[model samples]
Structures are given as structure tokens and as C-alpha cells.
Target: MNTNLSNDNEFENDAESRIETEVSSEVESTPEESGAEENLIEENISTSETAVSPTSAEITTPIEDNEAAGEVKEVKTASAATSNNQGMSAMAKGLAVIAVILAIGAGLVFWKMKVGTHGESLNRVTAEDMQIILKDANPMQLKALAESPEQKKKISENIAQLLAVASQARKDGLADEPIVKQELENIRAVVTASIYDQEINKDKGPMPQFGYISEDQVKEFWNDTSHEAEFQKFIDSKLTLARESGKFPKDKELTEEELKQAKDDFAKIMIYAEEAKEKGRDLGEDFNREVELQVKLQQAQFLAGRYAQKVLADKVKVTDEDVAKYIAEHPEYDTKEKKAKAEQILSRAKAGEDFAKLANEFSQDPGNKSPSGELQGGIYKDVPKGQMMPAFEQAALALESGQIADNLVETPYGYHIIKLEKKGEGKDANGQPTQTYDVRHILITTTVKDPTNPMGREIPVTESVKAKLAEEKQKQVLDEIVANNPVEVAEDFTVPQPSQEDLQQMQQQMQQQMPSRMQPPPAGDIEPPNSQEPKKPQPRQ
Candidate 1:
């Protein structure tokens, strides 16, 4: 029964089952329950997308606020239980795995592919040419612009803002302004250098599950010429399997002709490879490195994920007692800053004010507000540790239902004031830590230094001040564009703001359908793999 995959698949589905059983909707929930968990994905990755900016007509017209926030994810039930159970011996499973491996002997045939060289070269740019680049360019260049992890989160938004700035320049007839001209030119340079430039990066960077390779990997590998044959082999294998598998549930089996055509489309990229070098606009070599890498990265990521699953997933151990013992031993987990913040929040809660009212009025967390601008009504239920920031999870585990934190909890996202609504191992059967929490919180984000120009040049501003100024100016420009072209959002594009509970449920469901992802350790704290220090425990994937 494909025993090699049995443990891997089950380890993947555990979270799915738990969230499936207990995720109640926060369609009526509180932001305090956000617990810094909302920022988890944001803390690690930036995706690359090739956005076709709004046409001039789209620019002048009232832009659609197509961002929607009403999604409710449906869950996937695990297939019927397999013969293998928790009691199976390690040796028995190993032997079964070996048997399966031997039965599926490999025959990898690599064929050399000739790359195509047919696209227009992006050598020189005129004013009009620059304008097109600005309008059509996406946030790919934003990757280089991100110097810090926090800045990376803002890159996409900044790209949108930059696009707005460019559009306003056109409307104001300031094409020749040095600032306008330079910004557009810089954007063009960034765009022309990118490999595959068409997808919008909404998946928070990597394909979840595999956690191995990503679009960024595609870019890095694109410049290397050695992977061409290897990549083609990968494509042939995947397409061959797809052709045989009949493409899953809907079963739109690939026709013979369709398979041939698909193969041809892939072949053309290789045949046309040299064309990329023609334009010589400094976009670099003519190899279809991006295409080749894209093909390879998917498989590479999956392989890595598989290896980790086989070797590491079983090492994770979580139980109610384990969590309680964890809390008892990790006193240093709390910082002086966090302790003070928790004390202040506790004082406010003890002053006899309604807790929910305080969460609505004073909490700055986005989770507090729903898609419809209504405050999410109740407590967040059955939040697994995997769904929460590690610090938040630790702090929550230290409390029980109706129990409030005596000290503050800090995570990369912010300070959290937690009140555990419910706590038990059985709350979520699918989560890594096994236990879950029904919790509420008040989030206090660290403040950024404000822009202050003390004296003129004699008493200069700090680098922080300079950065803040740039931010303020950028915002002013975006505000102008919004004023000129008010947003008229598409109904489908409205961003859904599910409650913390709903978010956890949906995330659990989504992860089940995806390749188990590897979320990087939060910024700065991530150590190199060879470090002698203990490794941070990752959320079981």
C-alpha cells in the first residue's frame, strides 16, 4: 500500500483532521485572538509575480477595489485509514519501504534540448518605451529593493505604490521630470532582468508542502547552464505521469495530440533559448534559465520535502503533558520588555472593564476587524500551536480557558496580551502540538522611529529618520493617485478577512491540500544549519 509514503502522508494529514474536527468560524471573532499568528507567512517570504499594470483607461477611471476578504476554505477529508498504524515497528516499516523502492526501479533518460532565441531584445529605452515598462512592470524588481525581512513584506505594496506614482506622473504631464524619468528607468532595468514574469505572487512565496525550491530558486538557477538536460528530463517525467494518471478527480485525461502539443510548447522554450541574448539590454545571458529552473525547482522542492518527511517528521513529539513541561522549563522565554507589556495589559483587564470592548477599542491588530469592518464577535477557538507564533503559542500553553497571562508575550509580529479561552490536547486532533487554545489577545506592535529633522544639516537626521522620510513621501504620492482615481473593486477581488478561528481552520485545510511546507525560522534568529546550538522546533509539516 505504498508504505514508503504511508508515514509521510499521515504526518501531512494530521493537522487537516484536527482543524477539520474543531474549526469554528470567527466570522464573529476578536482581533486579540490574532496572537501574532497572522504575520507568520509574512515574516519569511516574498513571491515574484509579473503584473500587467492597469491600462491608461484603467488608470484614469475609478479603479476597482477588487481586493476581497470573504473566502471560507473548504476541507479535504483524508482517505480511508491504511493498514499501517502507530504500533508498526520501525524495522518493519523500513523493510516495507525498501521493498516498495525496489519494486519501482528507476530509468531516468536525459535528453539535451536546444533552446529558442526569439524574443525582442530590451536594449535601449526611449521616453515612451520607459513609460510602457513602468505600466507593465511588476514587483520582481522589488526583491532587490528589500534590504530587511520587514521591508520585504512591504515590497509588493510598494510596487503598487510605485505604479501609482508612475501613473500620476503621466496624468500630470511630468514625463521629463528627473525623478519621474529615473524611477521608470530603474523599474525597466529590474523588469527586463527577470526570468518568467507573469504570475502574481499571492502564495506567500513558496509552494507550501515541498518547502524546498521556490521562484527565487528559479532565478538563481536560471543563470547556470548545467541544469538544462536535467530540467528537461524532469519535465518529461512529470508530463508523462500526468498523461498516465489522467489528471486526478475531474480526470481530463490528456489526449495524445494534447500531450504532443504540450511537449512542443515546452520544446519551443528550449529551441528559442538563444533569442534571450539578442536584445542585450543587459538582462544578461540568452539561456531560458528561468524556464529550465522552474521545471527543476518543483521536483527538487518535492524531493526535499519527502526527505524531510521521511527523516524528520517523526522526531516531533507533542502532548498535553509535554506542553505543560515545556512551559515549566522555559522561563527564559520571557523577556523584560514582554513582562512589562503583559503587566500593563493585565492592569487594564483587572480594572473591571469589559474584555471584548477593550479588544475592539484599543487593540491595533487587523484580526480584530472583519472583512465587513465588523469586529469578529467571539473567542478564537481551537488554535493549534502550528497556527500561532511560537512565542504566542508558548504563552497560551501556559494558561487555560478563562485564564489571562500574568506577563506579556512577544513575537516578531508584536506584543500579545493573551487570555486562554479553552485548552486541551483533544481540541484539535490534526495539529502538531496536538493541544489547542481558545484565546483572546491585545497586540502592541513595536513603534517605528518617527521622522524628525532636528536642526538642518548641522544636526542631521539618523538613518532611521531618512528611511521614514522616504516612506512618508512614497505614501503621499500613493494617496494622490487614490484621490485621483478612486477604487471600484471587483466583488470577487474583495479580500476576505476570516476570523482567527476561521483562518486557522482554512489554513489547516489549505495545508492538507498542499505539499507540506517548511516555514523558515523568523528573521535574524535563523541560524545556519551547522550551528552547535539547539534547533528551533518547526511547525510539523
Candidate 2:
């Protein structure tokens, strides 16, 4: 947080200090308003919903919208779970630096600058001036800071960064804003005070929570062992960001000489970082109480989360009996019966009639009518689960390539007099199993929604209600799981809200991140790229 220091062993080298900024940016907690926490949560929400999947390999299994082809891509893109108030809270109001864990990143270190107490020829910020700047430089505090000659000399060299922050704020259209100027002054003041506090008092109160986060309980739900691909993907993202941001050299890879220098810097950082961490853990009675509260709260949330998954996922079943019982209990569960009126078509196909020819002549799939009097049969090629209704999928799966069902398979859409053209087993690039079913079916549309009916429509048969029944039962099961697990927080703990100006500045900083937001924050947890409508759609497949 304290950006400037001179003649210090920990960050004596300018380049080392600049590199340290990357680690500093890795705070575990920021107030609810922080951009860093928001981004992290966005990336990790899928970690929860797919309790079966790791946060790393969030697979896409989209349910196609029959209304429009475009909606299929939209649903797949937005499949990640929402995480506004999940796992742990993000509010990390701190006296200084919001909240940073000693663990910066993989192989990175924390630099502890021993200042004020050391008797060396170096610049510093006076204790008095720091307080004045932080607390809006009151008349009395300003008068006292000016009168202290020794204190003034200590701060002469390091105060420029504070001035620069002010200058940057003005250039960004915040100069005329009195509240914005004061908030900037306050953040700088806190940073300066924290430095002096560390220098003068090694009594850092109590031992704070370990590494700012405990991953043990989270591991209970996310036990997937396949992460080698994820690790490489993570490394690739870092490398790409470096090139895109110009944070590292513009070349694709570091030069030999550059790599050597970086290695040496990394070595020095590791040594000093360990020392800083050791000192912080044993820094007397001034332990970070906020961190302790956050750790405890997170532990409790993880416990509840694990329990919910066990009950909802591990215990719940989707057997045929479950659906039957649900329908019996709630008459509304059985959607209008839709029977594929394909007795004549099935008989013709079984009587040595060409199945493809029969499908082209009799299939009633919507939007498949041809102007030339030729039937354009709608075909499902290399179909996966959830792309088609459960009954249709199961019936097709039971048949081998080139096999046709003797009886009609009923689904909510109607019925499928089906034929399996092909079946293949394969793995995607990420090494997950991919079952491809090239299925040919002539759908007979036998049901339509009607406002006149009590259940909002009328269907012809009970066998056709599989899809809607399955979806409703799944929701009911999840609702039951949440109802069973009671997650409670410490009643006494409360997070303070930010003021108008503070919230505005936080919002501004978030917008400045890559793909700068062109519009306001979304009502939902997910933030779309740049604007409500993305500039361009990048295909995930």
C-alpha cells in the first residue's frame, strides 16, 4: 500500500519494487466495491454449481432453445453460476491495504521494508503529515505538521506518489469533485500510516488467519483430480495477458538474458518474502482481527455448502418411479399429453419401407417444410444429452447404428419414430468423455399449448410428459436440499457500507480493467464484456 520508500533492504532495487506491485495487487479481501474481488468471483462461481466439476474445467452442456437457434449459443455462454453472496463475503475494509494475504502468487514473495527505525540516509513520510493527509488535513493537524522540521525532512522524498495519485485523479475528470479528492487523500494517508506503524511497532497484535483463506472445506466439494490441463490453461492466460498488457517484453517469450535477470529477482524476492511472512505471523498483539472474522465466516459457509451438496447431489435420485410419484402427488406436474400419431408410419417403416424415405414423407418437425414438395426431414446429428428430450435420447441410446425403434418414443414435443444412424465414443480436447449420437427421427407434433385449458394447455397422453416432469423434479430436489441445510453466520459480525464517492471510485476502477465496461453494472452477478451487448461473440466451442 505504501508505494514509496528509500534506502531499504527489502525493496532497495527499483525494479524489484516495481515487480512487487504485481503481488500487492493480489489482496484476498476488498470492500464489496473492489474490482479484484468481483473479477475473481466471476471466474469461480461455476466452481460451486458443478460440484462434480472443478473450478478449472467448467464443461458446457447446453439445453437448446427450440424457439431460436441464436438462443442456444447465448445459454451456453451464460451457464456459469451466479456468486454475489456465495462461499465467503468479499467486504475487506482495512485500516490500510484493504486486505492482502502474505501469499502473493505462485513462487512470489512479500517485501517488508524496515523503515523509520533504521538510521540511514533515506527519504520518509512524517508521522504528522500522514495523519493530516489521511484525515483530510484539518487546520490544527496541518499547522502541527508544518512546524515539525525533522518530520518534514523524513517525508520530503516519498510524498510525490501521493501527489501523483491526486494529479491522476484530476486528469480522469475527478479534479472538481471534492469528495473524490478527499477519498484519494484518505487512501494515501492510510498507506503512509501503515508504513510508520510497521516501522515503529513490531507488536502486530495477534496471529491473523493463515494465508488469508483456508481451502480445506472447499476441497471437500471440489475433489476432481484432473487439473493438468487447467494448470496449462492458467499459465497460458498469464502469458497472454502479459503480451496484451505490455507488462512484460512484447516478444512471445522472454529472452535468455531477460529470463536470467527475472530468475535472480525471483530468488531475492523469495528470501525476503519468507522473512516478511514470518515477521507478520509473530508480530505481537496487533493481529488482523478482520481477517480472523472472515476466516471463521468462510469456514462456516463451507460447512453448509458441503452439506447441501451431499444432500442435494449425492442423495437425490432421478429414477422413473420418482417422476411417477411426483405426477401422482401433483396433477399439474403432467403436462398436456402429446402422442406421436405415427401408427401408419411405424407400420410402413417396419414393412421394409425405406426409413429415410418414410421420414422425408411423414416427419412433422417444425420449420422443415420444403417449397419443392420434397419433405426436408429434420435430423439430429451427433447429439449429446440435454440437446434432445430424455425419452427420445434414452430410446436412441438403446439402439445400435442403423437400428430403428419398432415402437414410437414419446416426449413432451410429441413422439419420435426413430432410427440411429451412428454412435461413436470420443474425448474432447480437455479429455472429457464425449458421446456422439447421430440420430434420425421423424417427429410427429401432436400437442399444442392452449390458454383455454386449466393447466395452460392440453396434451393427449401421460407418457409424453417426461421432459417437463424431469425438470420440475430436479428443481424440487434442489429446493429440498437447501431447505434441509441451515447455514448460519455469526450474528454479531457486520460489514460497514461505503459512502457515495467511495462507491463511485470503486466503480470507476472496475470499468478501467480490460474490455473496459461501456455500460453500467448488470443487475445479475455476471458482468458481460464491455457492454450489455458484447462487441463480438467469441465461440466457446
Per-model TM-score on C-alpha atoms: 0.28, 0.32
lDDT tens readout by residue for model 1, 208-320? 22122344554555556664664444334333322222222123344555444333333322222333335343443322333332222212122212221222123221223
Among these predictions, the greatest TM-score belongs to: 2
lDDT of 2 by residue, 50-165 (tens): 11101101111111111111112111111111122211111111001101110000001112321111011112223332332222211222334345554344233213222222
Candidate 1 error regions (>4 Å) = 1-342, 348-361, 369-378, 425-434, 447-541
User: Where does candidate 2 have its weakest 10-residue lDDT segment?
Assistant: 98-107
Quote the RMSD, in angstroms, for model 1. 23.6
Candidate lDDT values, in order: 0.31, 0.34
Q: Output the number of the lDDT-best candidate.
A: 2
Residue 207 accuracy (lDDT) in model 2 = 25
Q: Per-prediction RMSD in angstroms? A: 23.6, 20.5
